[model samples]
Target: MDDRLRERFAGLWSRTIGPTGAEAAWRALDAGYGAAGRHYHGWGHVADLLAGHDAVRALPDFAGLDHDALALAIVFHDAVYDTGRADNEARSADLLAAHAGDAAAEAVRAAMAMIRATAAHEPGADPATRLMLDLDLAVLGAQPPVYAAYAAAIRREYGAVPEAAWRLGRAGVLGRFLARPRLYGTAHFRDRLETAARANLAAEAATLRGGPEP
Candidate 1:
């Protein structure tokens, strides 16, 4: 959220997504999703991911390209998120095409592909995709209070599910995350956040099991 980052994000919006349409998309995101929904994967999430991306600048042979496209992808990645539906990516892609036009449509498609690749939990995927996925789930390693708030917000987003169902489903999701060789594929994140993320996941799993809180 620094001025330089904000300016970069703005530039991405203006050049890639169009200022007018981007503004409209922002309005739609804010109004349609409400504040809590926004917190789940909104501007804050995009900013966090961008910050994480910036953190990996020391990687060798990291020739940055099409950052505007990546930025657009981050912005729209969860644009149509719905807990009840399994095709959020498709819906998000559709919305991006409708709102941002052809170039953004392609970017959205590529971004969705990258997002879906994370579902495999493989360690050997494209480095950028791995980094992006890690950033998306970076909250797993956040301070307890922050992670707790995010956990509550995510639960609220899926309020229709019963507590038992939510607990089981969420534990399954977190288990998959913990099963990965590294919580974050980037060397920086692997070194700095991996242990914390595993600890957090274990604590969350305990809570899901109705054990004592951490």
Candidate 2:
């Protein structure tokens, strides 16, 4: 699977940025995502995002989106993830822009915006960015077992946090999402995932708060 993903990324780089720095960029990506402390925000997560992008690219609803730009953005969105950092998205966007150089300037600009959108998962003014946010958050609406594993992986990523602080912080994060009127920004995702995502957030928040799971 990693090999397949690496191939896809290489093809994207070649198409978007020519041959320059492609191999070095992939090596950077492999090392960054394969880091020992990365439990969730890793290569597997990148693969999932890319797969989701591929699944939706052909849909008429997303026809106006720049699919290639979205693909590049997805590939680099979490390329600099760190559990303790607040600027991972910014750093990742900068990294992509640097590697892309001046080639595909429009696409790179769009992709950079999309990459930054993951920082808050907010639906900004751009449709492509909204979709990117939705893709990053699709795990929120996963089936119960998958969602459980996702949540556990997140916990493991932040394992250095003391138990009490972790619980408080985790519950706070879930509470913010639960309080939102809609978890998914795009209508396609909202229709298909909103209910399940809400239920999952509520249940997880309850568990984190020592209340009964919903």
The Cα error of candidate 2 at residue 88, in Å, is 0.6
Pairs with steric clashes in candidate 2: none
Evaluated at residue 200, the lDDT of candidate 2 is: 88
TM-score of each: 0.79, 0.95
Top model by TM-score, which number?
2
**What is the alpha-carbon lDDT for the whole of candidate 1?**
0.68
Lowest summed lDDT over 10 consecutive residues: which window, candidate 2?
205-214
Residue 68 of model 2: what lDDT? 84
Q: List, residue by residue over 11-118, the lDDT tens digit for candidate 2.
A: 998887787778888887877898998899888998888889888988988998888889999989988987888999999999998888888898899889888888
Model 1 spans > 4 angstroms off = 1-10, 17-20, 32-39, 57-61, 104-109, 115-124, 211-214
lDDT of 1 at 200: 87
